[model samples]
Target: MSFTVAIVGRPNVGKSTLFNRLVGKKLALVDDTPGVTRDRRPGDAKLVDLRFRIIDTAGLEEAGPDTLEGRMRAQTEAAIDEADLSLFVVDAKTGLTPLDKTLGEMLRRRGKPVVLVANKSEARGSDSGFYDAYTLGLGEPVPISAEHGQGMIDLRDAIVEALGPEKAFDEDEDDEAETDVDVSAGSFAGEGDSDEDFEPAYDDTKPLRVAIVGRPNAGKSTLINRFLGEDRLLTGPEAGITRDSISVEWDWRGRTIKMFDTAGMRRKARVQEKLEKLSVADALRAIRFAETVVIVFDATIPFEKQDLQIVDLVLREGRAAVLAFNKWDLVEDPQAFLTDLREKTERLLPQARGIRAVPISGQTGYGLDKLMQNIIDTDMVWNKRISTARLNRWLESSQIQHPPPAVSGRRIRLKYMTQVKARPPAFMISCTRSDALPESYVRYLINGLRADFQMPGVPIRIHFKSAENPYEHKRKKR
Candidate 1:
């Protein structure tokens, strides 16, 4: 396992900025607002010859255990406990505050190796704050500008020294071996490149990207924490406690999965706050980037208009989805509720008919295995591809069973069909007078395809392309 490093500091100390710099990606949200990060997030980071698991944690604060700030501090402490080292960041421009001293004392009590990081040291007058950080007794502070990528070499040397010589040597050896594996895995260049060459690298070894999204106060964070078997994410009775979409790596049944716990999304009219708007946008981005999305719903209030809208959005985005009903333990009548929910799922969301709906309790861990199995099943179906011959055969039988409607005394002829892509399977069909095809006729073909292919609960796209005539181009040339 890679060595772990946790970036811990008080609010607005540029910890997230340094995390982004090390990970070489903008995975964490950075803002001027204090206490923006409520959960600790992990990322694979590389610094020169060093490699480790970098954790960006919520700012440390003192509050009652039941309060929100207290919960945030709990998450930060959890990260520090799991990490091999702590990067105690302090804002050089602002100088050391009382809270910084308290945090320093707390880290010293924990007896963990910590590298004092003096952030925002780019200004000329920030040297005084850098000198002040020495009083914390954590060793000489490494003055670096996290945003501007200055003084990284000194930080790298400090980390290597803290990790000790033996560990650093082993890591270098691992990196050398990993470099060979990456080169072999990425060697796809050839003279004639095809779709096979451009296909995304998806295998059992790679983590399955799953995004959990739902309405506010729907227990999204609770469900994720249950899956993780820890209080890895902050959870509370308050609505919208989760403001940023945070991703966590998990191992489920020996399969790697990257689970994303997103902010509870509300309707546009209800989302008036700018922070909420940013949170919703981040959630949408997670959905777009995810391979599968689990739309959680409160069992008592399932199938609301907003819930249906979110499902439709997922379908439009061409993502595999499974409907998860949380808080099932609270239900008084499970039999009747399940029956009604299945009926409504089929009736109301006919666009994605036969979608899998699993009743689970995020708080009690009821039916979680079934939910995960169904999600895996849905992902498999979403990635399924039908052969061209099989597609044409199905098309022939479907057309013979129920031919296209006649338009202007001429029937629309669908001559050929082929699948264009998978991952929410899309197809293209060559047809005569494509524009004359009615929406009902298109729906008929879609339903036929779904039934024949056994593709349930996954979105399918069909595009009609007009058949080209050879004589038309000749006449145009003349």
Candidate 2:
């Protein structure tokens, strides 16, 4: 097994910077603001020959149990408890605050192994603070600049010393632990690539990437905690409590899933702050990379403008989506509320016709099984492929049922159709005057394909192309 280490410290001590440095990616959002990170974000870290799982935790703080800060502190404590080792970061330039000493005492009480990190040691006056870190009684301080890439060798040595040989990684093993699969790569099959290249043969051995996105306080994180059966993420009554698009690996019915909990996306006009913008961007990125997206909606106020906008964005990105009506326990009339929600969804989201909307309560774990089943079902539909001959047959009957409208006083004839790809199920249609074919006709064909092939909810793309002229090609040469 690989080693696991958690970075812990007071706010703005460069713990996240250190995490980004160790992981060699800007996976976590960093800024000068204190308490920017609230949840525990994990990443795979490799330091030359040594590799381990590293978790970046929220800064330790003293707050009431019910407050947001208190919950963030609780998350940090949990990470410390679960990790094999803890890297206690202290700002060498600013010296140590009273909170830092209190945190040091707390770590000491935990009885877990810890290495004191004196960050910003590259600064001219940081030597005094580096010397002062020894007073925390966590042993010698490893002074390094996480931003400037300074003293990483010393940091690696300190980690090895803290973990000891038994816990340290073996130098001979060439293979590293498998990280999350980027299922979003090559989403579109390019030219010279066959249709088989985009086929989605799900390898059950790999984790399915699912991203949960919704407005703030919509219980995106709560639903995940329910699935985990633990309070792994920080939650409170406050809006916009989650800032990062945090991802966690989970198992459902023996199937592995890497679920991402994204920040609540408000309307674009309200997103003026730089931090919130970054959080929203991260959430959007998650949507693009996910194999399936769950768009959670608040039962109390369902189908807000922003909610519809989010759904549209998911469909446009060509990701399979399942609508989750979270907080179902709050609704008084379950049947009536669900009926209204379904109607609204059908009206607002024509792009995703026949979409599945599961009523679930993140707080009480209601209807979670149904939601999981729908996710699995939607994924299957997203990967559905129709045979070329069957596609052409369907195209013939569909055109016969509703003939294409006359464009510029001439009939537009659709000659043939075939599926070019599966993940999102894109198809190409050869037709006369393809450009003249109206969008209404395209919608008609798309709706027909969805109903005929049992591919509901997943986005279906149909590209129209004029049929090649064999006689024109021969005569042009003559």
Candidate 3:
């Protein structure tokens, strides 16, 4: 059975730092900025033999009854109530304060096991606060530096003592539930799986797998909803409502397309929860696996750093990428928007060849058909494969059009090229000296291949390999 624990304290007392430490990852954002964390995040944690679930909550503040802060306090109290034990974290360097006293009394009245964590206690003069924490009446304080990895052993022992030996565990039902939940989650931790509604296998053919990605509240899910003619994903004025990446399959004009509705990605500076961390991982996985990726950005606020990160991931993973400016209906000027998008792409990510940017409106469905057509065209380009004859033929024609540059007064021989794989085509080229090849020249070849083959908006890779003449090698062997 999974036991629960909560790390409760005021803001910036290293509660999130300790949460990230126990989770064994930088899943929670640890900024010096106060109130950066607005949600209660939970993750599976382990310290020594103590395996359980740990929740990191928003800092508890003194609020009047039934206000926002009071509701937040209720959430903290409820999470504490739900846990098997609580870790009350405090800044040992600053010593005891009135907030500490108020929370101490609150935890005391709750009657749950509490372990006082004297955070930021690694340096000199920290002993003064250590002495002061004793008066809080939460038992002995474990002096520790969460960022510096101090006092973890004592923390582990405290956890085991509070949770262990309380009751006998039944492993069978627990394992069953965990297995079910894990399967539903797939690569992610918290999301439930789709119902396998679209098989993509009816006619011995599959449609293009296209995924929609962007920063949070950028109309990613909105685009998919318009294309499907319904709001399959819950839509609202609130941001961050769609926490799970949802997928739905449909036919778009003789093309079988699987569209993934992903949660809006937020910057790491903005993400502070265990759930948001899992959501980001899930979205990244979808981008990697999908054949074509259509990144949606809000027309008003496009090309933020987080959006750039999404675009970079798609390109790095070699997926065909199409940029969509969603909520075009709200844009006051369409021509200016497209111009700015082109300028942004050119300035920020010029390495991409055959990429496309389109303006779309998920709310009014104005440019929905054009977006679908672009996706189909892009997916077609991504899946293009060429035979060796066609590839070498193109190579010869390309050389005739503009031969490769000479190096050190010697003509560089570009012997051959052939497609190796194509879910976004990757090719192999045989050359005399690949070390002399500039990335710009390689990009030239890729662009020629894309233009001549009528492939666009899909990522392509060109690899140079040095190989000896096969006929001479065969003759020598004989």
Candidate 4:
């Protein structure tokens, strides 16, 4: 069995850099900024002959007991404990600090084997600096350049030694734990892709899987009641009601749509009650499963941090996002209120630039039609398809405007770009130097695609394959 190795370090110390390097892909979001990664992410690790499952954790920090950051710390610590060997990483250039010492002591106390990693050690800034790392009491430190792929052979030998020679690893283990979400990508390329074949055969052909989600007492049940013209879910003035996600099917303009009525989620602090937590989890599951999420924020009090977190989670999951400002009847200035909502959505979530926001009073039935129309429109955007010819044309413009800069004098050639999947669209790029591609340039292409194709709010994914066009190999030239 392939043992697990976890890369742990303080923020921006290049733990994710090592992770992406080992994985031979930029699966982890590497940024100059710290605290960009709020969650512990996992991926495959490969170093020459060595292979294992690797986890990238949030930059460790000691927070007060039971706080959110503290909880995150606990989660990372748990991962460290679960690992067979821990790659305790630190910024080699910055040298060891008190936090590094503290982190080392804490890790050693766990009684697991740890390999000290002094990252960013590509250049010999100070030859004597390597001597200081041994003082942490983890024995010899493996100086590595996670960014430059230096000292990897030494690192791999260390791992095989740590894991021992006798352990037979099954290569098929990762295939069993596969995470690629199997979604259909129907005939389309470049700009837009459709999920044509993989979708289930619904009874009446449900076009949109709409989910209504919001904070407690945001009138989600009431709004759903308005749609059904009958009491569907139990409604109450209490903070957390509607324990389960309830699906309601309805026809709008001869189009079939299934709306999932989810429980009102409260602040994580107030969610200690077992029942409320379960309800929140259920709602989240529905959000992942649904085609479009209608964020139901109360017009009386809009855009809570928890609400924003939910929206962020949806975006991260690559699901389509549509905001439904419920209880609009309560707002004092209707037109001014909408203007603020638009500004807030646009400014706060700029990556989702130009997404649609539908205003409605779930109780008054004031704007349900518009909300439904927005759902259909957003779904169309989610299932968008772009042809190969148009995609390359767009790619050419991207290269000309803000071309990829050379890394180590290697001018990266972005050979081709094409959309292979949808719901939300996924693009695969054939590039010579995928490793050197800057995050800024990647974001540029994403933003440009969204703006040019009118797929602003939909989740757009880009995958880089080093080899010549993978799809081209399968085609038989007549």
Number of the predicted model whose lDDT against the real structure is largest:
2
By lDDT, rank the candidates, best first.
Answer: 2, 1, 4, 3
**All candidates' TM-scores?**
0.91, 0.94, 0.55, 0.56
Q: List the residue pairs that clash in candidate 3.
A: 354-457
lDDT of 4 at 410: 82
lDDT of 3 by residue, 1-478 (tens): 4577899998779888898888786656566766544456666676665567787777889988455456456657778988878999989888888998999999999998888889999978999999899999888888889998889998887666665655313133444222101121132211222222211211214446777888777887767777888645555566765554555667887666777777778887878877777677767777776767889888888887887888888988988788888888887878876887788787887667557888888888887788777776776666555667777888988888877788888777799776665665788889977888777788789778778877765677888897766698779888
Q: Model 2, stretches more than 4 Å misplaced?
A: 170-176, 180-206, 468-478
lDDT of each structure?
Answer: 0.87, 0.89, 0.74, 0.76
Better of 2 and 3 by lDDT: 2
Task: For each candidate in turn, give its C-alpha RMSD to the true structure in angstroms.
Answer: 4.0, 2.9, 10.1, 18.1
Q: Higher TM-score: candidate 2 or 4?
A: 2
Q: What number of backbone clashes does candidate 3 have, counting pairs of residues 3 or more apart or in separate chains?
A: 1
TM-score of 2: 0.94
lDDT of 1 by residue, 1-478 (tens): 3588999999999999999999887777888888778899887888888778888999999899999999999999999999999999999999999999999999999998899999999987999999999999999999999999999999999998888866654554344222101121232222123333243333445457899999999999999999999888899999999987888778888987778899999998999877788889989988987888999999988888999999999999999999999999999999998999999999999999879999999899999999999988888788676667778888998989999889889988899887777777888999999988999988898888888778999999999999778799889989
> Model 4, range 415-477, lDDT digits (tens) per residue?
887777667888899998687788888888899898787787877889887865667756856
